[model samples]
Target: MKQSEFIPLTLITGFLGSGKTTIIKNLLQREELSKTAVIINEFGEIGLDHHFIETSDEDLVELSTGCLCCVMRGDLQEAIARLLTKREGGWSFDRIILETTGMADPAPIIQSLVLDKISAPKVILDRVLVTVDSVTGLKSISEFEECSRQVAFADILLLTKTDLVESVEGSLEKELMHINNNAEIFKSDFGIIDLELVLGEYKRQTIAFTENEIDKHSHSHSHSHSDIMSVSLYFKKPIHAVALTLFLELLAEVLGSDLIRLKGFVYIKEAPETPAVVHGVQHIFHPIEWHQSWPYERKETQLVLIGRNISLPWVRAILETIEEEVEETTRQNEN
Candidate 1:
């Protein structure tokens, strides 16, 4: 199916009391997001986040069974499947926003979107927006592993509660950068920020990485804030498509959940003119999206993996070995 035909879904997540609901409530009020369907997954039996959101009943779905990530493979997939079915039945909505519980880990939720046979075909993951409390975000990241993971997996980091705090500490921003340098950070007052900045299509441009930056973060070391880290990889040569598949399969088999998120553009020898967009969570990967053309002048393979206890050198070595073996086999067949 064409990319435009798929519905874009954004994930809104944060630690408890980090203003995730506030951001959703505010976004729903905006005219640009009026036709958006919301799925609010709150912890415990009685859900309250959905009640706070004042959208049409038909557009709102509440999952109060438990944490979203825990039951995401089943309940979350069903919720999205139902929403897609409703849209087919004349429900008017162009996008979907899932607000996960504060305690939820985003990896499984992302996996559901990538792996679910039913919903994966219809919905595309647009972005992951994680709200961080300007006042308590630092503490949350330090204390709660879930909060740190949320920050690590974010595509856009929203620093909420800025209005309440005297001033957001540089330390908090630094800490966030330490966890995920690729995420775009924005300061929000009362959950108000330029919606276009967060929802813009231009933000989908392939991430660029420098050799030095990759070298700096390549080491496997422990951070005081959290063990979660990001590794940027840049490869000049085009990779065989078969080799890419082998690399991903090996990663899922070996790392599993420790591989939180992986996104990048691959330069495939089979389609060297257009870069292949790769996105994955845990063991599941979205079907490769082949762009019409390279977004930038320099066409190469660039990948950023976010997770815990992941070594950059090991990942790089794995890809190099797989591609080398695949190339050798191809040469043998030709000869």
Candidate 2:
């Protein structure tokens, strides 16, 4: 399909009380979203009327019957079709944003767009933006599968209600990164954030890691929640391609579902000029993105893996073995 013909559709999802509506309410007030149509799907009896979005004949839509990911799946596709038809009929909009129910899983919604014959042509899946409430997120992730899946599938993770907390102390941030390393984390207050940050060029959305953030997490945190934990590894030297490849392959084979997500920037010895951006969900690894240059001052490898019932020491040992083999091979070649 031609890029010009495809309309970008972004998914705004989160667990219960993660502030999805609050963020969309603020976004609709922006000029950038003036041409955007919205589909709000809520579970149970909650309504969108509280958001105060100015409802016109065609601008807003709501679906309430269980969750869009399950019961309302057909309604979601129909809503997209209806909105597109409205655009063709003269009520114009450049894009669409679907705000999913707090209890919904977004994977099926995403699958519908990719598999559906009609909607697939008209709409393009743009981004998955998930909001996690900073105050109550830890308990939520530990207690809920829906919450973790929301985090795992997001392209960007926005932390809301940050004002309610004294300091995030990099604790929440670390947990989020482990859940989905591919997503760049951002903090929000009252769900207010720049529209440009949300709708801007996503390729340049790498989070700038500061020395303080690195220092704060110099030592890993102890987790009482054994089901979910994140292991962060850093390498000062560029990794050999063979070693990196072997490490990823072995993990994907052994860990599989236990490995929820893997995302990081790796400086490849083969391509020192350009760094490799890796993204993996479960066992499936997407094509590695090679950035033209490092996005931050720290030109080192940083990987955060979020998994359930995974051993950090075993993971570390595998990586150490790979690096040693690479070094040994390098010395042999030199001699």
| Superposed model 2: Cα runs more than 4 Å off | 1-6, 44-52, 61-65, 70-91, 106-127, 152-189, 203-220, 223-226, 235-249, 267-272, 297-301, 311-313, 316-335
Q: For each candidate, what is the lDDT? A: 0.84, 0.76
Best by lDDT: 1
lDDT of candidate 1 at residue 109, scale 0 to 100: 86
Best candidate per TM-score, number? Answer: 1
lDDT of 1 by residue, 257-335 (tens): 8888888889999999988989877667788889888877888888888887788789889999999999999999999
Flag clash pairs in model 1.
none
| lDDT for model 2 | 0.76
The deviation in Å at residue 62 for candidate 1 is 1.3
Which parts of model 1 have CA positions greater than 4 angstroms off? Answer: 2-4, 84-89, 119-121, 206-209, 214-223
TM-score of each prediction: 0.90, 0.70
RMSD of 1: 2.6
